[model samples]
Target: MADLVTEIRERALALGFDAFGIAPAEARPDLGDKLAAALAAGWHGDMDWMAETAERRASPKALWPEARSIIMLGINYGPDSDPMAMLARKSTGNISVYARNRDYHDIIKGRLKEVAGLLSRRTGAEVKVFVDTAPVMEKPLAQAAGLGWQGKHTVLVSRQFGSWLFLGAIFTLAELPVSEPMAESCGSCRRCLDICPTNAFPAPFQLDARRCLAYLNIEHKGPIPAEFRKAMGNRIYGCDDCLAVCPWNKFASETREAKLFAREDLREPPLSELLALDDAGFRALFAGSPIKRIGHGRFLRNALIAAGNSGDAALLPAVEARLGDGDPLVRGAAVWALAQLADGERVRRGAEAHAGGERDADVKAEWAAVLPEVV
Candidate 1:
């Protein structure tokens, strides 16, 4: 069993996993209380699902008692380019490094299954692979398996891979030797907290997801709060402020996975181009990428916010066309974009044109407010 574990780790490394480990399928007994405390403090925000599945998340054995071992893997997806460089180009929407190309879930899942298959062949173990999709607490398990410790940012940070690695897990029936847990190395750093534009972190190792740009742009289903729009800047897809500001990233190497590298077109997409995308256009452009999952309406909604923060009147016409869009969320965001441009007369005229036609109450209220000067 020890030789098999060694062979599995070698194969996983050869298959491009930057870090790998195995752990017994037992719950971290104290994690449940910690998670309960986090929930009580409202650190999870509107990610109600996290709180809802607290029990299963706190324990791997509770999730699947039959699984005697967990094989944790981390794949580096670091970009050769600076993720922060796009901020200088205000008109171009700044997507986070992870989402700039192929979705990591698809890329890593395929590789995980391949490795799991090898383990099955060698040990005749029944296996199930997961990458960011299951209720299983991957970070805690990875930490226990010696991959890395959960940083103050709440993401696993490795000495070797930094925080640029994507996590995945394979649950198996075979009882494998458990790797020792990694010790927390972020002694007193607060770089991630200070770097947050919206101050999403309430404290170290805790996040208020509602205030997070990544949650607002991706997980959020309705109109983005007016408060977060400007702070969002040109980040149309997700925010990387916390991750980018980490000092440990200096040790990170660029990813060799061509598919995970940033796509030329997605690197710094013009807000105008993104705002111009209709549903079919969005699908065509974001094919095989996670951005496509948000659909055109939500995506354009985010693009409009970026355009608003862009302060470039050049995108006004594109924003104007959406004033009467079928989606109320898009219409509301368009009105906000126009307000940021502060071309009141143009916005008033656009509002008048859609007066009787507009039916959504939220959008109508936004149009009504546009007529009143901000005193």
Candidate 2:
């Protein structure tokens, strides 16, 4: 079994995993307390699943008692260009580096299955593979396995790969010797905290999902909060300010995975062009990518916020066309965008023109407030 574990590590390295480690399937004793503290404080806003499955998330034994060892793997996907460079162009939407290419879940899951299959063949043991999709507490398990320590951003960060690596794991029935855990290296560093545009991180290691741009643009189902909408800037998808400011990223290298590299179309797509996308157009543009899962209505909802923040009159027409969108989420976002473009009289006229048959109370109220002389 020990020799098989050694061979697995070697195979993982040969297959391009930047780091590898192993830990027993038993839960970490401290996880329960940590989760209790996080949930008790109301830090996980709107992420009800995290609170509901607290016990399962805290312990691997509770999740799957039969699993004896966890094989953790890391795949680096750093980009060649500075992720922050696109923020200066306020008219162009900034998609996070991880989402700029193929979804890591697909890419990493395929590799995890291959590795898990090889382990099963060698040891005659049952195995299950997981990326971020499962109930497994991958970050805690990876830390236990010594792949890296959980940094202040609450994501695993390595000295070698920095925080640019995506994590995956394989749980097997065979027993493997565990590795020593890595020590937390982010001593006195608050660059990730100081750089957040919306102050999403209230403390060093905690993240409030409500104010998080990633959550707002992706997980959020209704109108984005007005307070954070302007701070969202042209970030139509995920925000990378916290990730990009990490000092450790300077040591990271460009990804060798051609599929994970930044696509020119996503890097700095014009807001005007993005707002023009209908459902079918969005599906075709983001095919095979994680961004596709958000659907056009939710995606355009974020794009409308970006168009509003752009302060560019050129996008007014694109925003105006969506005033009557069937989704209240889309219509509300269009109201916000139009308010940013039109002044008192124009806004009044625009609102009156669209007000005749509008049914959504939110959109009608927005129209009433922006009437010509009211501005």
Candidate number of the best TM-score: 1
lDDT of 1 at 12: 86
Residue runs of model 2 more than 4 Å from their true location after superposition = 254-259, 368-375
lDDT of each: 0.85, 0.83
Report lDDT (Cα) of residue 272, candidate 2: 90
Highest-scoring model, lDDT? 1
The residue pairs in collision within model 2 are 348-372
RMSD of each: 2.0, 2.0
List residue ranges in candidate 1 displaced over 4 A: 254-259, 373-375
Worst 10 residues of 2 by lDDT: 366-375
